[model samples]
Target: MSIQNFLSNLDPRLQRMVLKNEQLEEEGLHTEAQKENLIPVIAKVTNIGKFQKITGVQKVTEITTAPDRSGQIVTAHIAANALPTVNKSPVVIQLQGAQPVKPLLKDTAREINLPSPQESSGNGGEGVIVGIVDHGCDFTYSSFRNTDGSTRLLALGIQEMMNDRTTSFQVYNSQQINKALGKPDPYKELQYPVDKYTHGTHVTDIAAGNGRNNKASGVATKADIIFVEPAYWDIPRGNLGNFGDSINFIEAVKFIFDQAGNRPCVVNISLGTNGGPHDGTTLVEQAFDGFVTDKPGRAIVIAASNSYADNIHTSGVVAQNGHIDLHWSIPTNDFTLNEVEIWYEGSDTFQIEVIDPQETTVCRVGLGELYHDGQIFASQEKSALNGDNVAMILCDVDREDMSTGKWTIRIHGSNVNNGKFHAWIERDNHTIGIQSIFAASRDNNYTIGSVSCGHKSIVVGSYDAKNLNTPISYFSSAGPTRDGRHKPEISAPGHGVLAAASLTGNGVTGMSGTSMAAPTVAGVVALILSEAKALGVNLDIDQIRTILERTARHNPPSQQGWDSRYGHGRVDAHAAVAAVRAMAEGRQPLPSAVTQEEKEALVRR
Candidate 1:
């Protein structure tokens, strides 16, 4: 492959790193760049050995191999100088965006036939394992402890800082957690004071908290818990997409399953980024699909996303030999970087040009090319695996020279066989730092996050569980994937959900997001898995989706079946378990899809 072609295959971050390498060498900063540059990536390949050998890899770990044995997902680090070798040999399968690492839930458990810990054991999810991969976890929370004050977390993997330009993890088993709990200062002795952000702990509580001190209980309270603090956001205050990431979640999932060792395990990943094809075909989504389908009694649930009103998506049909101007605005005083990804048919090509807020063309990326000015960057590439094209506009607001305001993106159709194209603003947390968005012709559809698009993933959206209407959360993302496949198989309680607060000594806290909803479904899945295991019936991802689709309670009460706001509907934990029991007894058969009448008829009370 030519150097340019090889460069196009690398992710946007690594591509920039490669181009920057030569400049740094010229300035005698090669060593400094090496010290600060550790590029960790997840790639799918047919031959792992060849991929490692060609990439000059010092270490390689296998995350997952697809169920149909299509490819293997592996993590390999590339030095700044090794960029040229990235996809030249043993090609690295690409996802959608160039997400850099930055530092970056829950429900009632009683709906699933749980009385009280004293009255009943709540064995509905007993003998199952629940896995959590999120920003951080608080093992010291009483909700995560047994009645005797012993830790309920089976294993906790905390991502350590990058050392020698490589990511590492420090794992603690129940024994180690117990040892730390016995210390005079557990937080000081354990060396992890991540209570400031209780994201992981809250989500975990919604999945497996034991209802300590009469707090809000989770569905799978009796299930063992495995928590993973993702490496990218393990530090202090990082945006969701600014820090280099992923592959850590895959590593964490693999670790949890390894520890599970044939025990029915369900993983709840309450975090995701809006940077992928959203077609269940990206390498990351492929790996997630593999995780659940590769074995029976295994499942994964992810947030549908919370960007419904973010105005991050826009779509239009570019006329042949004509152009469409897409307006994008960068909020003022924004210090962080922002980007937009455009995807269309691979057969058609478009001329990409970006006009700044000042109405001056900053950069024009040609067909099958990459362009980079000091403040702006652009690129277009055709996927060799999936026959889809992806183009991107990235603005570096952190640069002093970069301007912030309304910018116009001009996409001129060249070969207009299929002019329909969709563009998305990559995930930005938009805390105090201003976030950029599409200013005009914005779209709300196809807002589901990256990995949640997987076919086998039971994606969960957020809803107002406390409201009488049980309304869909205003922030819950809408989706019918890029390929027109229904996503977020179900919705769940997320608005003002009462769950655990980290390091608060059994105190309860209320938070809301799709992150809270995912664990609700995961906890319910654990109940199904536990019952399945006891009945000597193993359930695969297909069966799980079917059971969920058939059991969810419709949101609008008369909306019939699936809608973008709520897939099948809000999750019904009790209905799902009953269906699982019926399936185990051979008294009920799983239906493939909602029938026409099912979509037309109002959901009767």
Candidate 2:
């Protein structure tokens, strides 16, 4: 897999844990099925998604069989012998020969032929599809419009209201988007409340905005667009709602890729969670790896989360025949749930207990047991990676006088050998600001969040786009995953990236985060896809990763190749695209013969 080739090569991403909370009925979370299950579960799916830690594979049923232009995608469900199998895939990529050159990409208008496809005359991501899976997808923005005032969006998928949770995919094709653009209130016509979410619009614009608003255009201006708005994405832990799972994120990516058809597609994910075994084997991460490996001409880019300084991670070891207590601080004002996952070598059997801030043992679970009350839930399960075990505790208060501040989790080593463990507090996505944290033993390292840590994801870190003095954004997470795999393949301008304000006609705003950087890479990858399509070449995940890493520019100049912060260095779109053209032409893909002026020119852009 190309992920192994990433930063001395190794892999990592998480399953969306369904917490029994009322907010599950919102935008990306509802499915009706989840609404009724009122308890936080690491749910197992019998079909149609990815699964992890299934001890045996009793059955393998191919859900859908079709030959993708790149390769065929065979999604299957694997569950433990007693439990219904999870919809996970042991992804098999049977690479086919070069696909015949397809037509010019949708709405591209013209075909380009240049010796160096990255030249200004080369198409700006034409002949490629850019998929965006995030919230607040506003297709009405001018940046998404063609020169003729028509939409450049290929399609948009929304997880509709709760009643419609069981309904089929609610899709808006290009015609529907165009119709919405003509109405008095485009959102009313489209049924997407874009005003609530500007994140998607900003990310999409950065990846493929056409620059119609006199603002800076995105990297792949002419690339076609596909978007999916997961229901639970917009509001994070609002109304004392339960914590939402990222399974919707996986579904969102699947929908985008499904909608993309055979076209070369690059999807951007500016969303992630701070919890998961950093070893890249969580069910959802498995899904990500499966999807990316399903075929060539497919790739996913994720923001390498901003939890670097959040104190969301901690690590320690329990002495054999001894015990340890982990302190987790629940903020005084936070009304949402707090979840912490402790991962350790499975060879050691540990009994766990969760104590509230009042110093009372609220719930206890021994080896192979799961304890759940409305307020506290604890469990110990076989880990999906490295034959390890995961101890998880989640708190959902029941009374008005809820416990606040440091909660202690006690881990007693019953059978000890390899008693070391790692833990992470869940991420906060909304603006309420308050979040739980580890009170002690916090480690900023290994902070790249799940899905971004997936083996197939092109994880991106943030550079201070607006502050050259700081180069890297303070919040951009540092990594070499828990398993010691280099992460954050590259860095890009994220801070202060200005783009269209959600649902505001002609309005723009500036936002900062690693979320802003990932889309930048997605757009650049689109250019690479476009070039590959033009040259009639087939590119798998590994090949694309190689090109990007090979062409990255050294950030600090003296820093040697491949560090945890920036896998290669900062991404160079022009160099990446040029390398693609060079590969197709059988020349030096990343030629080192460029003149001083050309290097400066690339730097200037």
Candidate 3:
């Protein structure tokens, strides 16, 4: 029988036990389910015909009524009608259409397998410094407490140098002069107040907030943090831009690294402009690559931009001229056959192609015949150019007005009713693919970080370290770089991750983003470095990336080779630590640093 008919015949008591008063005998659900009149009903046991002949039960478990017609009910197996069910003795309650329960971490008695006791002293990032290139950190956070329950960050670098306090943390006038002179300010005071977004504090918590007092802590909980405020947002003015001009960023990156010295440090930038390398070359790259000395363990991490332009907004334009393809910003994914498309404008035809970032080619084409329909015709074929160049495809269309003039480009991952590709028509090109970072969902560009001034260093990605089946967040940006180089290098736990936040503030907020994911890898890096110190083996940034990538748990679901989405798959801190430990003991092959110089050179260039 159909569900409606079957429910209508069931006894009222049976219905209450199974369907939770889903449908009424007299008036039906809609008539009786008035908002205020609706009441939740607990399930009770009932009897059926021959089904009861097998098992015996006194009563059925209670089910709550839907609130205000906002619920549905169904039934399946319950305790036997003949068998006695003891109270609170793990009764097997069965219901139809119940969502499958995801096993909790606790349910699976998998030991929290950290490395050997000495390897996991929680001092992976000991002595190293990380700059929270964000708003500002709260020096008074309770997470900075020591074993004796005293706060360790009595004075932070930013708070000390910026504030008027007389402790050693104070930023003296000489330091202020150095900062003003474009030199490294060892005593630069914490400039922004604690309440400004609390971004720096939260980020600091992820990178190095010592896990104190059951507080949310980061991977490298004991590392030092330098707060750098690079973004200033004015809600009234709608100004959400970087602190200084591009030139200022060049100076800032260099200064941070200069102060880092011999210890390994990572400068984390969680911000970006709205375009590609051509439209915007992360201003810091100019200085970071130019002047900073290549210390053994120092590196930088920059956030991929969060800007996205659909039909309503477009930020980066992609076009081609002749054999050469030009892009204003990095496309969402590497140029595959999947991304290329050809269009017909009346009798003419034109094709769109995305080229490699490193190629230097020029386009030899211009605006042409206009077409009324979406199709554009191929007017002619020009000679192959030497470098990347983008030009408007010649098309036939009538338009004198540039303002509000629209064009369309077919796209994927949109809401197309049929199994057809969607198209976006906007005034400018959409930001192609900043959303493809390792663990970043499409919502915000939080977790992505560039290695240095250059875009080449490992931009870490996210994975559900605890749950293997969950898909990588839809927001995680994917990349092969614009040049098709495997990026993000690898992944880590970025979902529902526990980490520190401002102490004086809410102290903790459940956060999920690539931002949360990157630190897991960063923490592992700290562990590797820490182990290296003990073994007296010097390692470089490239070596660290290689070790992690080689030891990364291979995910078969990821695209062929290393995919843009998952990269090398989720990182295993324990596995990575083990690999590094084995290498230190000469039991396994050490990861090669072939990409190290290239990575550093990319930053410098």
Candidate 4:
């Protein structure tokens, strides 16, 4: 009998809710008996109310055929009232298994309409090392090499050395090092050699592999990928409760950071600890935050863990009893705020770092005075063109302010011959204290400073492509550090992306996640660093974050600005390149200290 008949037989009240139409045909109903017997049978026998209770579905709307012709299918458009009140309802239906789709590769790869990379005319990110901490990488894969004797992908086997009893580096045979060196295969015992599962390889390819031989490309096509294997073969017995120890992870990080390589490099950590970092129990923080540092051109880019599962920090923060919390607050008891004092010891005399904010850590250095209205003002002391420190002030721009005037931040360059001022912070002044107010406004980027909490690291989040349809990957992590600061200093593409993978010979694999997202960013960073070096612009990680955040593409304000989900909306590679060019030509202005509003506004755009 049809599902409807079954449901009607089970409960007559369900008859009106279940209907038959093209949906059944779409489900591939090949025979009349199957069609006639399924829906009514399902409706008659199925407990609609019980099904709704279990699935958070309102009244059953329709009983359709399965996408595949295997069986009858049912779908429901849930009601607002049917949302899970106590806990999230797990999806009960098992989806049909699908084969991986091979990504299409263009004959000539093109970057999304962002301006061509500044240093991309020649090799960019060449020789820079990026670390991928995941399952494993297949060094023997062919896509890792190029035809002209240049290595497109170089694999540093981290898993092979996992269980070696020797503390000495020589434990790895000469062959393994040869593989790392891109030399002919010389190794004997190759356990966990090439990444058997495709996750790590796909991620590595996006960061480094050259788009040669009809392969999908990566953003940093010239970088070297160092794979840090976290576990042995998937312990089929692995369970959520038994998260594995990541000693190899820590060791891999230490090895990369300690490498005395020549090229200025950046490390990308796409994986995130499942629990919230603020819970104070995740070993990830102990390994990452305790070690990653900001020293000149070297840095690390970490993806905020995606909020797929319920989070006490986010979900719990929602106000109950009609007390909706539109904002987060800093605890008054925290001494980090009251102890704020400007300490300057760096050689750069033109800029001072804003170290503390109402106990929240939103650290960034700008050329200006700490002003009221929670902003940093550029110094008008010198009538320096564009670089003058007066354009960084942020205001809680109400409708009146928008109607009356628009605010702007300035950038200054050393090449300006005339003493013209470029102010980046100039808005009406308000109360000046070391605290941030949790208000919903376009200029509230500074209010949630989680991503920037670890001011010393390069924190990134993800956004949809220009086409913007599709759930933001549930795997991409969000930010607003436990301390109430904006995090993921910026956002990038983390979705159903196509990139090169380690298949046997010049092969490719397809996958998606921030794991792919972060390497694309690291490559961009490498390009920026190259431009800065060429242009003689001495920049720091904070400067890069502020520049990227300020110049990124802006989405509508209906979506919160600098929210944990998408910090600084989507990255505008073109805008970033333009900013770099303008800075190099002395056409751009230097930014003043940023106010909460100004910073938020920059990030929102």
Model 1, CA-based lDDT: 0.74
lDDT, candidate 1, 27-111, per-residue tens = 6654533544545666777888777776455467887886557678777666656655666664455422234322213334533
- Give the alpha carbon lDDT tens digit for every residue of 437-481 in model 2: 888878888888855666668999887645445377778898878
Give lDDT tens digits, candidate 4, residues 1-605.
11111211111111111222223345664354323221111111133345556533433433322222222223332321222220123332221100010110221123333334442332455555666665546555554555554444344544332111111122233345445446444223443345344776666666666666465656556566565664423211101111112333444555565552544566776654321123221222323443433245566676654443222122211111221211322333221211111111122223322222333323333432233221221111111111122212222222331212212121223232322221111111122322323222222222121222344556665544524442345545555554356666666666656665554556654455556667667666766665566666656666666666665544521253565666665565545555665677776443533233543443233
Q: Name the candidate that leads on lDDT.
A: 1
lDDT of each: 0.74, 0.65, 0.37, 0.40
Instruction: Assess candidate 4 and give its TM-score to the true structure.
Output: 0.51
Query: In model 3, where do residues sit more than 4 Å from their true spots?
Result: 1-117, 120-122, 145-191, 231-247, 278-283, 286-293, 302-387, 390-456, 465-468, 503-506, 556-561, 590-605
Q: Rank the candidates by TM-score, best first.
A: 1, 2, 3, 4
TM-score of each: 0.91, 0.79, 0.51, 0.51
The count of backbone overlaps in candidate 1 is 8
How well is each residue in 251-341 modelled by candidate 3, as lDDT tens digits?
A: 3344455556676666655443322222112223322432222546655554322122121112222233222122222223322111111
Score candidate 4 by lDDT: 0.40
Output the lDDT of residue 341, model 2. Answer: 80
lDDT of 3 at 435: 20
Name the runs in model 1 displaced over 4 angstroms: 1-6, 29-38, 90-122, 234-243, 399-402, 429-433, 555-557, 590-605
